[model samples]
Target: MKLIGSTSSPYVRKVRIVMAEKKLDYRFEAEDVWSEQTQIASSNPLGKVPCLIMEGSEAMFDSRVIVEYLDTLSPVGKLIPQGGRDRAAVKTWEALADGLLDASILARLEATWPSRQANERSQAWIDRQMEKIDLALVAMDKGLGDKPFCSGIHFSLSDIAVGCALGYLDFRFPALDWRARHPALEKLATKLALRQSFTDTLPS
Candidate 1:
């Protein structure tokens, strides 16, 4: 198996953490999605990072899909639940965390464009994304009140996704001061950071 992505991508980090937690070994092929030489389009029509190529070159796009498939490969960590409402609940948390990252990445990229930097419309769009991120942090904190992990006591996919999302914010928006606003999340991030998986996959 091979994992294709950039270190800076939060989505990629999610998949990498899943792989590490599962104790699965795979070749890591880092690529710059923004580079014209990138082959992401061949494996993924959307030309996205975090594309996984299995032994036979079966390409898996989308971090959610790849991570879920990887979870089934080994019983080591079992990030997602097997069945029942528990599975849905964990997936819901993953969706929320992924959505938060999606918005943050969009806003960060939009801010880099010189034209968008001066355009009120673009700024408004970025503001909306930031608002969504803010609300998501509050909701996550509330949902995580007095819990050791996001979905339950055990560290699961929800924790991995949330950790990656928060790490992305720390890497890109240091000025946001999210730790002060959401202490619960800060605690979660701090604990997860001690894990080898998180440390190994930290974005450069």
Candidate 2:
């Protein structure tokens, strides 16, 4: 398998962390979707990164889809639960984390994308996205109150997704000071950082 994505993407990092935890081997093909020379569209019509090309040349897009499929491939370190409320809970945590990333990316593009004219850049839109991120953090903190992991005692996909989201904030929006606001998340991030999977896939 070949994973096509930029090192900077939190979504891509999530998938990479899962693969590493599962002890899976695959080629990493870095692609800058923002560059004019990028051929991302050939694999993902949406032009997104984290597209996985499988053994038979079949392509899979969307980090969530790729990670879910990967969890089924090996039993070394199961991330997602098998069924019922447990599976739904893990997925809900993933959705929250992914939503945070989506807002962060949107706000980042609004504030920094050079293609947009100064007048075209909307500070209001950026602020709105930031609001979503802030709310999500509070929710995460409340949901994770005193737990060893996002999904209770076990290190699961919930932790992977949340860890990647926090890491992305540190990489791109350090001024947000999320660690100070939410110590639980900070603790989680610190613990995750020590894992080889998280360390190896740190956002560049």
Each model's C-alpha lDDT?
Answer: 0.93, 0.95
Candidate 1: where are CA atoms >4 Å away? 114-117
Give the Cα RMSD of candidate 2.
Answer: 0.7
**Which candidate wins on TM-score?**
2
Best by lDDT: 2
**Candidate 1: residue 168 lDDT (0-100):** 96
Clashing pairs in 1: none
Clashes in predicted model 1: 0
lDDT of 2: 0.95
Cα RMSD for candidates in order: 1.3, 0.7
Q: How badly does each model clash, as a count of residue pairs?
A: 0, 0
TM-score for all models, in order of appearance = 0.96, 0.98
lDDT of 2 by residue, 82-151 (tens): 9999999999999999999999999999999998898999999999999999999999998998999999
Our tally of clashes for model 2 stands at 0
Give per-residue CA lDDT, model 1, range 97-172, as digits (tens): 9999989988987888555435544778899999999999999999998899999899999999999999999999
